[model samples]
Target chain A: MISRLKEKGAGDLLKCIQCGSCTSSCIVNAVNEYFNPRRIIGSIVKFNRLPDQDPWLCSSCSICVERCPQRVNPLSVIMALRMIKYENGDAPPSRVFELIEQIKKTGLAFPLSNEAYEKRRSLGLPELEMDEESLKEVKKILSEAGF
Target chain B: MSMTLYLGCLIRTLYPEVEKAVYEVLGRIGVVFEEPKGASCCAPLGLFSLSKNAWLRLNERNMRLFQSTVLTVCDDCFASLSDAFKILSEKNNVRVPEVKPFGKFMLEKLEEKGLRFSFKGLRCAVQHSCHLLRPARNVDNAENPMVVKNVLEKLGYIPVSYVSELDCCGGLVFEEKMRDAIARRKAEALEKSGADCVVTTCSHCMRQLKSVSRLPVLHLAQLSALSMGANPEEIGISEILLRRMVNP
Candidate 1:
């Protein structure tokens, strides 16, 4: 896992001195004390494995990145961890699949609703439409990415 | 130069008022823009985290539509789109357009047109999205970190200083229980600031903050639209919004 993370661009994992500043400054930690960034870093550096749900708990705001004295960029490390998980056939929550499915179908995160159409029409702004070709291309990209 | 507007999923589906307000306000300031097709979600936090390639190619495909600038109200989208572009362009040699968020982009145009408006002394708590302010390199150069605060002040409004004003709204994490707690905690701090309305730039933050706070939430475009000659009622802003919320 250490070699994989290094290859996956989380080489900053080596730079961490485990100062615990990240866990202290983390906003998520303020609410759930168990969601400690320090523990994640320590565990990942030591065992190269993340505790259950640790990486996903991060909001990816990069506050820890800005606060890290070692410039470790823990958020990127978390992201790399997530990608590693997915590559190993571990899936995220169901909503992530739903989002990709929505994008595949509508080329959007959500389906455009009637109220939106009414709002746009009422405003007299020209309707914005995604052509079929564009939708096809979007699907192609998602498919190529193995979504 | 005119901008090519990229209405991501949230703005197009949820907050058309923000869309309308931004379009009308930009028109009022003499900037030409087009609502382009072929745009999709920037795969935000969850999607990006789970699959970086999907996030990269989807955004790159979307970027294939425009050159120079793609204007948006979603800072998360701007952050994701720009980061994807930087990664793809550097690694895979793919090209992508630039993303300009609402606050800094609006301030630039207002400066160019020499258009200034006052806020009539309304006090607002500006919610800064983490994506906009952090990982700062590769951002759209929104100028100072206080771009929205400066714009509010220029429009004659006061920004209330409060603890945790710069904290994330915690919208990125997918854990439902922890997500709600984070949102509620941040909202409590914001409400305690005693600001009139919670003002923010990102549509995602507006929704998340509004769900958790009793205070009225608004996009910076909504507040500035009222000041930029768009009718408050026409753009879905209450006519009493400013007068009722002004700081004592």
Candidate 2:
């Protein structure tokens, strides 16, 4: 677990000293009693398992990281946890995979649908345009990165 | 002198009006902004947490897609592209084009144009989105962005200070459970500031602020246009915000 977390991005999470600053700054914990950052850190440190899908609930806003005294980067801890989940054959939501596919296919988040085209035209903005070379390069990078 | 506008997926997909305002205001202020067509999502949400390597590579691709200065209307894109620039330069030893938020870009250009804010008595608290000011190396003024405050002050609006003004709006999490909590904090900021409305430089913040705060929220571009005496109808700001514009 330590090796996996280190490989992802939250290697510094081992520096966590049970400080509750992350909990105090966590927007999720502020709302839900079940979502506790301190407890999750303890679980990862003491045990080898991610508590649950709780890490996926993190907003990736990095507020806790901002407020963390040790600069332990609880946000990365969450991300590392999610990466572990993905590696264990637990795929992320299909919507996320769909977005990844969209980028590879069209070099866009979503196609400039007719509604958007009309909106841009109404605003006198030009239509979406991209060079073929950039698209091919993006595909190459994603393919090489094994994304 | 000119920059390619990097309208990320959020603004293009969900908030095209904000994109419209960005173009109109930037154009009005003498900015030669062009839409970069091939730039995809600035490493779309969850991509970074999914794979940091992929996120940086994707954002680098998007950043390199445009050869000129890149201006972003979405705070997430600003952070993502800025992160790409930082990683590519510092970590990977590669250089890419400049990616700046529309607020900072406009602040510089507006100062050059010597434009003054026309409205004199409006009060607004700016929502500083997390991504706009995170990761330390993404921007020079990540600690506290003065762009929005300066624009409001020049426009004759009060830049209010409220509790947790710098807190995250929790928009990045995509968690429905935190909506009420996010709304409460926004209400606290608005109530403390005693402002007529909230303003933000990020499209995501603008959307979240609107959902949470009872007061109307303005994108800096919309506010800039309104302050410069542009018609609200043409800029595509909501009627609620248009109503709050004093002496427009």
TM-score of 1: 0.93
All candidates: CA RMSD in angstroms? Answer: 2.5, 2.9
Q: For all candidates, state DockQ relative to the true structure.
A: 0.70, 0.51
Output the number of the DockQ-best candidate: 1
lDDT of each: 0.78, 0.73
**For model 2, what TM-score does chain A reach?**
0.87
Chain A TM-score values for every predicted structure, listed in order:
0.89, 0.87
What pairs collide in candidate 2?
Answer: A59-B173, A129-B37, B117-B155
Model 1: per-residue Cα lDDT over B46-144, one tens digit each: 777766677777777777777668887888887878788778789877556777888888778777777777546787898888888887754433223
Q: After superposition, how far is residue B172 of candidate 2 from its true place, in Å?
A: 1.7
lDDT of 2 at B71: 83
How close to the true structure is residue B96 of candidate 1, measured as C-alpha lDDT?
61
After best superposition, candidate 1 residue B86: deviation in angstroms?
1.6
